[model samples]
Target chain A: MGLVAVTWMNCLGRCLPQKTRFLHTLKGRQSDQILMSPSLASLDLPDTWTPNSSCQSIPDIRKSFNEQTPTVIDGKLMATEIRSKIADQVRQMKKCLGKVPGLAVILVGQRRDSLTYVHNKIIACEEVGMKSVVTELPTDCADADVQNAVMRFNKDPSIHGILVQLPLPQHLDEEKILDALCLEKDVDGFHPLNMGNLSLRGREPLFIPCTPKACIELLIRSGVKIMGKKAVVIGRSNIVGLPTSLLLQRHHATVTIVHAFTENPEQITSEAEIVVSAAGVPSLVRGNWIKSGATVIDVGTSPVEDPSSEDGYRLVGDVCFEEVKKVASVITPVPGGVGPMTVTMLLVNTLDSAKRMLNFT
Target chain B: MGLVAVTWMNCLGRCLPQKTRFLHTLKGRQSDQILMSPSLASLDLPDTWTPNSSCQSIPDIRKSFNEQTPTVIDGKLMATEIRSKIADQVRQMKKCLGKVPGLAVILVGQRRDSLTYVHNKIIACEEVGMKSVVTELPTDCADADVQNAVMRFNKDPSIHGILVQLPLPQHLDEEKILDALCLEKDVDGFHPLNMGNLSLRGREPLFIPCTPKACIELLIRSGVKIMGKKAVVIGRSNIVGLPTSLLLQRHHATVTIVHAFTENPEQITSEAEIVVSAAGVPSLVRGNWIKSGATVIDVGTSPVEDPSSEDGYRLVGDVCFEEVKKVASVITPVPGGVGPMTVTMLLVNTLDSAKRMLNFT
Candidate 1:
C-alpha cells in the first residue's frame, strides 16, 4: 500500500500531454492528465501494514474537524427498523384487503452472484409476508425468452413489482428487455421513463433506484445536512453514481461526480463536505483523501482478499475504511451499511408498487 | 428592487417550518439559507457609481486571476458560424434529395410570450432554408385537439420535428400532450421518454434540450475547459438548470446547482471555475459572488424596468453584467449571449431530426 501511494503521488506530479485546438465533437479533456489511478486497497500487503506517512495521524487531524461529531451512522439498525415497519404494513394489508404484495424477479443467467441476489430478494419478500417468485433461465437463453418471462410477470395481476436481474447474456439486448417491462411493474426503476422522471423537477419516477435510494435514506436518518454543501460522487454508472449525483443535487447539495475519466479524483473528494463513493474500485478513496469531519457513504462493496479471515476474502468499499473511519464524522461500513439498506429499499419500492396497483394508497 | 431585496433577506432570516422527517416523498431541501445578495451594480445610483469597497480595484484582482484570459465569449459570432453550417447542410439536402427538412409546432394558447417564441422558431427555420408549419389552437382547446395535431405531424414524413409550445391552458394536460408526440418527432426533448433517454447512460435522446445544448456549444466553441473544474449552475428549473447541470456533468465539469432553496449560494458560486446562471431573476448574482477566473454564461433574460430607455422595460440576466465582467475571465452578454444560441439549437435539433428521417447522415 505504501509503495502504491508513492507511485500514485509520482504519477500525479508528472507533466500532462500537449494541447489541441477545440473542436465541436470534443468528448473529453484535451490535456494528457492520467485518469483512474489503480486503487491501492486491493494490493496484497503483509498483515503488518504501516500507514502511509502523508496519510498518517488521524487523531491529530481529528481536532481540526468538528470533534463534537463522533456519530457513526448505524445503517444496520435503520434497516431493521424499516423492515419491521414493512412487515407490519404487510400484516395490516392482509387483514384489510385479504391480499399481500407480490414481487417477481427474472434471472437470466446462472452467475453465482446473481443467483445469490435473487435468493436474497425472495427471502426479503418472505420476511414481509409477501409472495415472491423467481423465473430462472439458462445462461444461453435468448432475448425473446427473457422478454416473454417479463411480459408474463407484467400481465400477472398478483405481481405488482417486476425486477429483471442485471448482467444479462452478452447477446441479449439489455435495453430492449428492460424497456419491455410494463412501467407500472418496474419496481427496480431501471426503466428509461422512470430514470427520466427522476431527473425532471415536476415529474417523479414511479420508483427510485434501490442503491441511490438507500444512500439518501442513510444520510437523512443519520442527520447529515446536505443543503448547500460541496458533495463529491465517485463513479458515473447509471445504477449508482449518476442517479446518486442527481439525488444529491435535488437534495440541495452542490454535487461533483468523479469517474474513471476524471483527473485529480482525490483532490476533488477532499473539498467535498459529503462524499458518496460508488466507484467499484477497492480503496480508491483513502482516509487523507476525505474532508475532515465530512460524512462518507461508502457504496462500493468489492471483495478483497484477506488471508487472516476464515473465508480468505472480505468485502470492502471504495473507501479505505480503517483510515477514513478515524477522520470522517460518519462513515458506513461495507457489509452492514449500504448493502442491507438496498434490499430494504427494494422491498419498500415493491410494497409501494403494490399499494398503488391494489388501490390501497 | 431595494425593497424586494430587503424583504427577501428578512424572509431568509426567519426560521423555517420543520418536524417533517425525510421520507422517500421528501423532494427538496429542508433548511433555507440566504443565497443571493442585492447586486450593487443594479442600485439606482448616479452614472459614476463606484465599486463596492470589498470589490474595488479591478486591476489588482485581474492579476490574481489568469492575466492572459481576457476572452469574452461572443455567442452571436458562434451562432452565425453554426447557422451557416446548418444552411450548407440544408442546401446539400435540397440539391441531393430534392427535399427539405420540415418542422411543425403546435401552439395551444395565445400567450404573447408563446406566440413570440413560436414566431422566432419559424423564422429560424426559414433562415436555414427549411420548411416550417405552425398549428395554433384556441386557448380553450381540449387535450385531444393538441393530440390530434401532434398525431397528424407524427405521420407526415416531411414534418421531421414536432414541438409543442409550453404553458398550455389551465384545463389542458401538458404531460398528456407531450407524451402523445412521436418519440422520433420530439424536437423539444420534453417527452418523458426522450428526457429519460437523455438522463440515462447509453440511451440517446432524440433531441437535446435546446438551451442546454447552446450553453455546451458556447463552452466548447470558446475553449472553456470543463474537466476537473468546479461549476455552479444557478437555478433548478426543469427547462434550464436541471438539464444544464446534467449536461455539465456529462462534459466532466464538477457541477453544483444552486437553486432558490440553496444556502450561501454566493459562497458556492465563488468556489466555481465555471458559472451558468439560469435563474430568471434580474441581477441576482453580483461581482463578489463570482470566482476571479470563472467563465459566466448568463441564461436569464428577465425584463427589468429602465425608465430612461426607449422601452419602459429592458432585459437583464441573473448576473450583474458590468460588475461580474471585471472579475470573470469570460462573460456572456444578455441580449446576444444565450438567446441566439437557443434559437440556433432549435434549428439544429430540427435539422438533425430531418437528417435522420431523410438518411442524410
Candidate 2:
C-alpha cells in the first residue's frame, strides 16, 4: 500500500494541471493562493515524504503551495443562471396556456431549519413565476392529517409538484405519509418507485431528488467528463449518496460508495478522479485523502457554532475546504455550493412536471 | 505499479491460508490440489517477479501450486439442504392450514432455454410439495393474453407466488408485462416497486430478485464476511449485476460496479476482497484481475459448443476457473454454483409469501 501510494502521488502530481483545464473553463476563475492552517495542509509535504512518516522531523512546506491554483466551483452563480432561464420558460408557458407551474409544500412541524427551507422553496417558486402553496400542521398532528394534505394536493390539477418536509415529528409515521403521496406530484423524488426507476438501466424516474440532481448539474455545467472516471461517493443516505452513486453509473462512471462501514476510506478515496462527500460530517475528508486533479462536490452541510454570524452558527461541509482546494483540481465551497442549487433544481422539476401534465411541449 | 504488485503478492501469500479458514469450514472439505494448463496460471510467480515481467524467461511453477487448496463453494449441496428444510415446512403448513405454497409461471413463446428454466422451476416446486401452474402462449399472442394470465394468478387465493419467464418474444412489451405483476406475488421480484424498496435504506422489498439473493446466500452461508469489505461487481445489467451491487452495499461492503464502458476494470477489480462477475462473457475475468485470497462468485453462464457432451454444448462462467481457483480463497464452479441456488431462492420466497398470506409463522 505504501509503495502504491507513492507511485500514485508522483504520477498524479505530474499530470494534474493538464487534466484540470476542462473543469477550470466551467467557472472562468483563475486559481489564486490563499493562506491555510499548517496543521491540516498534509498535501504540501515534499515528494520524498510518505504517508508513513512521523511529523516530528518534517519541515513545514506550505510555502511551496503558494502557486497551487484550483478552480472554486461557483454553485450560486450557476443557480442564478438556471433560475433566470426557468423564469423565462415559465413566462412562455403562462402566455401560451394561461397557467404556470405550481408547487405545493407540506411542512408538519416547527423545526427552524425545516421552516427556513420551506420558506426558501416557496420564495423560489414565486421567483420563477410558479404558484406556491404551503400546509402547516402541528407537531402532534395525526397521520391522517398529513395523508389528507398529500391526497388533496394529488387531486389538484393546478399543482404540478408536491413535497412533504423531511424529519417529520417523532409521532407521525414518515414512511406511510410518503407512501400516500401521488407519484406524479412527488417532486422531492423520495418515492420508492421513482428511486427504483432511477436505479434501473432502461427505466427513467419521473423526478430525481433535487440535491443529487443539483450535484450532477454542477458537474456537467462545469465541463467535467463523467464517463469511465473512478468516482467515490461518501455516505449512502437514500436521498443523496445512494441516488448520486446510481446517477453517476447511469452517466457511465465506475462509482464506488464509501460509507461509515468502509475500512481504510482514505486509501480508497485517494484513488478516485471524482469525489463527492455527503457524509454530513464537517472536515471528515482531509487533503491527503484526495487525489490530485480530482473534482470534488461537497454535499455535506452541518451547522457549527460561530459567534461572528448573525445566527450564532454557520454551515461547514464534509471536506476541509482550505486544505482540499490546494490539492483538488476543482472544489465546491460549502455554503454557496450544493446548498443553493437544491431549491433551484426543484423549480426545474416543477416546470418539467407542469410541461408534461399540460402536454405543452 | 510493478513495485507495489510484488509487495502485495508477498503480503497476501503469507496471510492467505488463515483468512480463508472460515469459508473452508462451510463445506468441511480438505484442501485438494488439481492440475492446470501452463498458459493461464499467472499467480504462481516467484516473490521477486513483478507484473511488468515478460513471459519468455519464466520457468514453469505449476508444481509449487499443487499445494494450493481453495474451498469450492457447493451451491448445489446448499440448495438441496435448503429445499429439504422448505419441504418439511411445507408439510407442516399442510397439516396446520390444510394448504401449501403455490407458484404460478407465465411463459410466452417456445424458446428452448426459457422452456427448460420453467420446467426446472415447476419440478423444484413439486419436489418441495408446492402446487405449480404454467400458462403458455404462442409466439404471436397479443399483449392482453399475457396480462390476463397474470391477472388470473393475481386473483387466485391458492397462489402465493407469480413469475413471468423473461426474454419474452422481442416483440412483446417486457416491461409492461412485468409491471402488471401483483407486488405480493412477485416472487421474481422484478417489479419496479420491489426494486425501489430494495434500494431505499429504511424500506424493505417484499421479495428480492432470485439470482442476486442466491449470490448473497452463497456468501453468507459459507461464512464469508461482507461488512467492511471491498466488493467489485462486473456488469450493470438490471437483473444480476445491478441488484447484486445494491445488495452488497446493503450488507455494508464498499462496492464498485464495472460495466462495459469502464476503463481498466481489472485494476479496480484487483483491489476488491469480493468479486462477483455477472458479465455473461466466457472467461472475461482472468487470474491476474483478482487479488490473492479473494472470494470470487461467478454468476456468468454462457454455453460453449462441446462435442463430448450429450447436449453438444457445455456451460462456462465469466472467470477462468482453472486459473482463478489457485488464487481465490473461496470459489463457486459454473455448473453447480449460483445456477441451482436461483431456483431454490425462488422457493424460499414462495414459502415466505405463503406464510405471510396464511398468517403462519
Candidate 3:
C-alpha cells in the first residue's frame, strides 16, 4: 500500500505539473475575430497578469486599444466569413450524405416586418445551399393551425429546424406554441429549457438566440476579452437583452441589466467596459453614455423619420452612432451591423441542428 | 363608423381608469417577513415619490435608516411565523383530504452532516404535521440502490416530495440520479425544467430553492422594496447564488453577481443597496465591505475552530457578523439567520407540493 501510494504520488507529480496554459475559446457562428481592448495599448497585460489555466485568452486583445482612430467592428465582413464557412460545411454534408439541411418556418400573418424577416431567412438558407420551406396561414387563423404546422415540422425527418415567426397575432398564446416545439428542433434557443441551460453556469443552451449570438460572435471575432469586464445591457426584453446579458455572464463578465424603471441609465452604461444596447428606442444612447474605451454593440433597429431620405424614414439604432463612435473604441453599425448577423446566425443554427441530426456534431 | 368610433373611444376612456394599484407578490413557500430597509429613516419616499400606478407599496420602508441602533433581522422569529402558518394549513389539509403530506428522503451514506440534516428535516416534518420517510443506504451502497429508492418513492401516492441529500458518495453519478427523480415530486427545485423555468422571465418555476426563497421572503416581509433597487449577489453556486440572482431579477431589482473570478469584490458589494453573500468562505466579508444602509443576508454556514466554545467549533457565515452588524442597517445573524429559514422553507415546499397534488393552491 505504501509503494502504491508512492507510485500514485509520482504519477500525479509528473502529470500535474503547474504549467500555465493560455486558453482561447472561439464560440458560436462568428467564431473567428475580436477587435481589441483599447486601454491595453502597451502590451503590459501579458507580463503583469498570468491568469489561471482555464482563462480564455484573447488574441491581439489590445491591437487597437486606446488608439486615436477607433477600430470599427465590421459585422458585415465577419458575417460573410461565417456564411461562407457554413456554406462549405453544407456542401460537404450534402456530398457525404446525399441530403441537404432543411429549415421550415410557420408564419401566421402577412405583416410587412414578419414577411421581410421570413424572406431574409429563406434567402439566407438558399445562400448556404440549404432547403427552406414556408407554411403561410391567414392572420386570423386559429392557434391550432400554428401548432399543427409546428408538429408537422417536428415530425419531418428532413426539417432539422423549426421557426415560428413571432408576434403571432395577439389572439394566440405565444408561450404555448413556442414550448411545443421538440427540444431537438428548437433552433431559436427561446425554449425555456434552452434558456435555463443558458442561464445556469454549468449547463449549455442548445442554440443561442440569433441576435445575442451574433453580438457575442462579433465580439469574439473582433477579439474582445469578456472575462472580468463590467458589461451593462440596456433593455430586459426576453429575446435580445436578457439572453445577451446571460451570455455575457457565462463568459465571466460581471453583467448588470437596466430597463424602463432603472434610475440613472447613463451613469451605469458610462461605467461599463462593454455596453450592449437593445432598448428599441431610437437614438436613446448618446456619446456621453459610453465609456472612452468601451466596445458597444447596438442591437436596436428602430425606425426614425428622416426628411432627407427618399423613403422619408431611415433605420437608426438605440445608440446615436455617429457621436458614440468617437467615444467608443469599437461600435457595431445599425444597418450594416447586427441586422445581417441576426439573419446569418439563424442559418448557422439550422445547419448545426441538421449536422447534429446526421451525427456530424 | 364615426359614431361607433366615438362610442368605442368613450367606452375605452371609462374602462381604463388612472387609479393607482398596489401589487404585493408573496412568492414561493417562505412567503413572509423580510425585515426593514435600514436607511429609509430620514426620508418619507412615498410622499416624495408617488411612482407610476404599477409600483408596489412596501409599508414603512424608511423606518430606521442610519439609526444608531441597527435593525437586526431575526430569521429565527420569521421562520417560526412561516412554520406555524404551514402547520395550520397542513392540519386543515389533513382534515379535508383525510391524508397528511409525506416527504421521502434518500440518504446514501451515514456521514455526520447528512445524518444531522435528515434528522432535522424529519423533525421539521413532524412539527408541521407531515409524515417523513428516510431510505438509508450503507456507505458502500451501489448507485442502483439509491435510484431504486427514489423510483419507489416516486411511485408512492403518499409521497408528495422527494429529496436526495446532496454530495452523495463520490462513485455516484449525481446529475443522473437527481435528474431521474420524477419532476412533479422535485420539491427541492433542482430539476433542470424547474431551474430553467425559474431562470426564464414569463415562466414560473415549480419551486424556488429554499435558501433564496427564505432570503427573499425575509426581505419582503421586513419591507425592503426590491423593485429598481441595486442588488449584488456574491457567489454563483447553482442552488443558492444563481437562482437567487434570477429571483431578484424577476422582482425588478438590478442585480450583479460577483463570483470566484470577479475582481474588487468589496467595491462591488459596497455599491449595492442589498447584498446576499453565499461564498461559503468564513469571515470573508467584513464590516467595511458593507454600505451604510445596505440589507445583508448571509447564507454561508462554514464551521470554524473555536477552542473557547463548548463544541470546540462554531458555525460562522461568510460575513463577519459582529463587524457587519455595526455598518449594515439590517443584517441576519449566522446561527439564527439563513439556517432556520432554509429548513423551514423545505417544509413549506413539501406542504405546497402536497397542496398542489390535492388540487389546492
Fnat for the candidates in order? 0.36, 0.51, 0.33
DockQ of 2: 0.22
Q: What C-alpha lDDT does candidate 2 achieve relative to the native structure?
A: 0.78
Error of 2 at B296 (Å): 0.6
Q: What Cα-based lDDT does every candidate model obtain?
A: 0.73, 0.78, 0.73
Give the TM-score, chain B only, in order for the candidates.
0.78, 0.81, 0.82
Instruction: Give stretches of model 3 more than 4 Å off.
Output: A1-66, A305-313, B1-65, B307-312
Q: Which one wins on TM-score?
A: 3
Off by more than 4 A, model 2: A1-67, B1-67
Clashing pairs in 1: none
Candidate 1, superposed: residue stretches over 4 Å from native: A1-65, A96-98, A110-112, A169-171, A307-312, B1-63, B96-98, B108-113, B137-149, B168-172, B306-312
User: Per-residue lDDT tens digits of candidate 2, residues A167-259?
Assistant: 899889888999999998899898999999888876778988889888877886666766568899988888899999988877667899988
Q: Which ten residues in a row have the lowest lDDT in candidate 2 chain A?
A: A32-41
TM-score of chain A of each: 0.80, 0.81, 0.82
Task: Residues A48-81, candidate 3: write the lDDT tens digits.
Answer: 2111232222232222236655678888888888
Q: Against the true structure, what is each candidate's TM-score?
A: 0.77, 0.82, 0.84
The candidate, 1 or 3, that scores higher on TM-score is 3
State the weakest 10-residue window (summed lDDT) of model 3 chain A: A38-47
